[model samples]
Target: MPATDPILPATNGVIRRSGCAADTVAEAGAVSLDVLAARRARSLPPGVRYELKGVAFTLPPVRALPVDLPESAGGDTAELLRLVLGEEMIGRMAAAGFTLGDFELVCEDWRRRNGLADGTAPLLPAAVRPGGSR
Candidate 1:
């Protein structure tokens, strides 16, 4: 938790949120890979497909920690993701250019492949997939 991060600012050695920082942190904390993927997929064309490659995403000081995170989490981001995204979400992943079908496909494929239907993610309800769920 560096003092430089915008979401969790350091003032006198204490961490606190300012302005929309709370909302941003809350949103980031509540985010799930499935829902994020679905939203991204919904915006793409049916025939659209991307390639797979490595990506880099930097988390801010309070990215994985919510302003109202339950105390039981013990300040661990992995635990928070598990609580919101499920145990299958052992960590975080990100992508930019070159992928596959949109992110939704990867999440689905992972689910079906791993049989990780713990029901903690895929926040967006199932809809008529653009490309038949790839």
Candidate 2:
């Protein structure tokens, strides 16, 4: 049957689980609490401690209207993380701290939630299935 049938409700009756609980996944990427305390001590200038307060990010956000991810980022999520941190958000792990692994984990989750990749999480057991339960 055509999906756009006028008689059918726009919804599937059951709200299956997707990548995110929110309606739209933030393009900046998902935040991880584990990275809240993300810090790496630096001695470049000698005893310059690094401390990130209130920001625990991984994927970083687009500067423009869900528009661009910065030209420097390319198609590489790791590069994106590296470049984005240096963009007026040193406290966001762009500084001399945080690792590629940290950023990648969050990006993976973001991808799934945004439907950019496979794995949308299984549909939760609903009270009723679509078109009504048996």
Candidate 3:
């Protein structure tokens, strides 16, 4: 299956078992939370210390903003946003000024409108199925 394919409801069970959905999403453009946190730390002002078990750690003095990850970190910015914020949460974020769009939903809607089966590739002229021509 293509990485961009929408995870259909019927396949949810298999996905839950295999745990490959997360991997697929990551491959599509999800960034590790660790990497994001580190990037945020670097943007903070110097000399900022956070108390943890009475140990002072000098780091950036600024609070991390809920900004979208950079494109370089994730090949597809929208996919990264979806992965990080999740579908529903992302809608709330979008209302708050984030420019990210729900690309997957859009694709799904398009597929349905075109009468294509969920997760099925679009028909191509001269294309043949594994067993025979369609």
Candidate 4:
């Protein structure tokens, strides 16, 4: 069946488990929080300290779609996480005294949400499955 039937209710779902982190002291490739805290000690606020926390990514349970096609029913939760996280990372960094200059929020948001090698727009709104739609 053609995907354009509009039989399926377009939705946005949370992505399943996957995540990555980068720190200020991040090496040529990757850096950990401990290293970041140490390297940026002088610049960091006096009361600030390094804290490591993990974020879990998980696929939301499969949802039933009005459409008959299996593909149309499945929501890409992982991709959503990526999109949210990427945008969140920028905000997080800003709060941490860093800026996401030249980083395309849309691109990062898209790639993370879709798990694409390159960023892409979300086919559905992010809040739809979270009990809201916009």
Q: What is the lDDT of residue 88 in candidate 1?
A: 35
TM-score: model 3 vs. ground truth: 0.21
lDDT of 3 by residue, 15-58 (tens): 34253233122443454355446665875544433333333223
Off by over 4 Å in 2: 1-54, 57-72, 82-86, 90-97, 118-134
Stronger candidate by lDDT (1 vs 2): 2
Candidate 1 lDDT tens digits, 1-134: 65387864454432234441222223523533454455555654333132345532222222223334423344343444345444332233332342334445544543444334644432222243232243
lDDT of each: 0.38, 0.41, 0.41, 0.37
Q: Give me the runs in candidate 4 sitting further than 4 Å from their true place.
A: 1-92, 102-113, 117-119, 125-134
Q: Between candidates 1 and 4, which one is better according to TM-score?
A: 4
Q: How many pairs of residues in model 1 come into backbone collision?
A: 3
Please, what is the TM-score per model? 0.19, 0.31, 0.21, 0.20
Candidate 1: lDDT of 115?
36
Decreasing TM-score order of the candidates: 2, 3, 4, 1
User: lDDT by residue for model 4 over 1-134, one digit each (tens)?
Assistant: 77554864532222122342333433444434564454545443232122223322232212211222222324443334334445565455446553333234433443444344453333445555444456
Report the CA-based lDDT of candidate 1 relative to the real structure: 0.38
Mark the regions of model 1 whose C-alpha exceeds 4 Å error after superposition: 1-51, 54-95, 98-101, 117-134
Name the best candidate (by TM-score): 2
* Residue 108, model 1: Cα distance from true site in angstroms: 0.9
